[model samples]
Target: MGLLTNLKDSVSRVTDRLFASEDPKRIGIYGPPNAGKTTLANRIARDWTGDAIGPESHVPHETRRARRKEGVDIERNGQSVTIDIVDTPGVATKVDYKEFLDHDIEKDDAIRRSREATEGVAEAMHWLREDVDGVIYVLDSTTDPFTQVNTMLIGIIESRDLPVLIFANKIDLDQADIDRVADAFPEHETVPLSALEGDNMDEVYDKIAEYFA
Candidate 1:
């Protein structure tokens, strides 16, 4: 990491530690479609609550509505925090039934999915305004980090003044470049992990216990 990057991360961590609260917080799992938002949510829920929030699929817009797993108590080495995990629908600028058709979805189902996905986007934004304490923004590290979805999401999170911890998910992939994501958003903390393979999951638990506890 560059000196500037290192400095920003250091400052952010110190700030989080200084503001750490005792009460449980509602932390949303947010990101663009197919970026492992649901995967990460389920992993955290499974470990802390013995349950999964929602299902995940390679097909986009699988989660058309928000799913909540309440009272997830994450404890590590005596440090712990209880959180309500809200696994929201994927935020996307556009949703087309044709895209689903490309995945071999039936026409009727595709249309319904597209409609629900569009509604889901609006609902996710609503939660940001009404119901959230902190957020875990999951990003696909294998793709370009400088996209409209990512930029807009970061801006919204900043505008809300939320404590965000960005996860550079899918690091097990050969093309993943976590540094690009970290450089793109220097103000927040970024931890690289593969939720599918369960790599570096311990760090995720530790971060939640540290920052959210």
Candidate 2:
């Protein structure tokens, strides 16, 4: 078989397997700045024996733009599954375009972008309210998560009634404290992880799978 033919066959097999699953779920991975959301997304996509979907990065906000990757025909316990994981920008209290202002954006341009930022916030609210099925709220384990941004995020999740799995990322950091963050978001399930090191990824896999189940 040619390369293209082989590729088509693989795609067909994955599709068939996923549709055959008992229940399939699409998950959105989101969180605040520097929360390792991208890292976690990539880890989950790759760590599974199935096809890993997206690229992984170590830099904060590396995934300012949203990208999707798919895990093909992931079968567990005699059931086939597909994980549609979306890697979105880390939620921010302010528009990131503001950075251009300090970097010398023209006054008129900056003003218009500020307006756009407002619209972006609205878009984010809509996504939180209507779009996503679940969220993996990635928190920096080294910092206190009870801040306004986190609290506001929590409120939004609660309002939408979306199931959230707290991903306490950067557990490898010297100052990491998963316990403290766990205390802050006591209602949700928490998983300590070092996305770079690929630590505790199985737990994340199980958590996400549970949500779908």
Candidate 3:
């Protein structure tokens, strides 16, 4: 048993080193639905690579697929890191078609959207387990931070030993609270920003370079 444990540890170290040395680390942008994750991802991709990852919508589960933009070279204060930005679908414990119906979506479309969103969430988890090197966990600052889905996702990320930066998005709103989000995840660094208004993006870029690198 001791010898087997040692072998596993050695393999883990080698895997870590290999991933660390690779260029353009894969960084996943993850959060709940309607958290402005796609907005932030579009901002980053446009700023550096002159591209967009996906469309944004006010409705929940708008992003029902994981989108990727490769070779985005982000530089801040002379620190730089090349990364493949993966904007993943929202991680949710429960997705109901009724939520889509509330958005005035028709029955058939709402049900289909719910199914796709659920599959997307599963795909996002798969990426975290096998593909992503780091995580950018976004949260809506206007909402309560203590959620079962949020806790479960963060715990999964921690278990995989992935470096994560929590983003408190939609700070332009009057009800947005950065401190609450920070308090929710005291172990991880949280950055307050309005992804829609392009506020405090420099800090985000700098932190990404610092943490993910």
Candidate 4:
């Protein structure tokens, strides 16, 4: 009996390995500036892969390019899914150099940052159109969820029939309202969590395993 159990366990391990070796799904993290997309991406990457995707910043467009961390394995309830995380620039209809000026950035650098941010938005859209297998749409729970950018982006994702998981981030704040975010997109699942505080991450992981896998 011991020998048989060991053999079965070995086969199960091999099966898990084979499934893990399959092509990883590409999940793009999208949201407006200061919505904590990079924060969440860094959290996910660190939890599984012991790495950071990008730096967090109070300045808008801090992540002026799409940063990708490949092969992150998230496991929950004995289920697992491997994904390539693409941390993208915040999607905004307009990016002005003057906005960075509020952060005390130099004029020349702010202008360059604005240009790069615009380009980054374009790149993010291109990836959504051609590469992304799933989406994690982060939103600031304290803010209104019915912005034009959010509507347009969600519409685009819906049009493509890509799977999406909406994250109502920053629940640690007193003003955070997860229900408001959920009600904005009643058709999809909305998860409430504070990525910075690492609150309710278990649900996030379980949902990722369930939806993206």
Residue 148, candidate 4: C-alpha displacement in angstroms: 0.6
**Reference-based lDDT, each prediction:** 0.88, 0.69, 0.91, 0.92
Error of 3 at 137 (Å): 0.3
Which sequence of candidate numbers ranks them by lDDT, best first?
Answer: 4, 3, 1, 2
lDDT of 2 by residue, 171-192 (tens): 9999999999989987777899
TM-score of 3: 0.89
Please give the lDDT score at residue 117 for candidate 2: 46
Point out where model 1 deviates above 4 Å. 1-23
- Model 4 scores a C-alpha lDDT of 0.92
C-alpha TM-scores of all predictions: 0.89, 0.71, 0.89, 0.90
Clashing pairs in 4: none
Model 1: ten consecutive residues of lowest lDDT: 16-25
In candidate 2, how many Å is residue 79 off? 4.0
lDDT of 3: 0.91
Cα error, residue 51 of model 2, in Å, equals 6.7
Cand. 1 TM to true fold = 0.89
Per residue, candidate 4 scores C-alpha lDDT tens digits across 108-194 of: 999999999999999989998998988999999999999999999999999998878999999999999999999999877899999
Least well predicted 10-residue stretch by lDDT in candidate 4: 12-21
How high a TM-score does candidate 4 get? 0.90
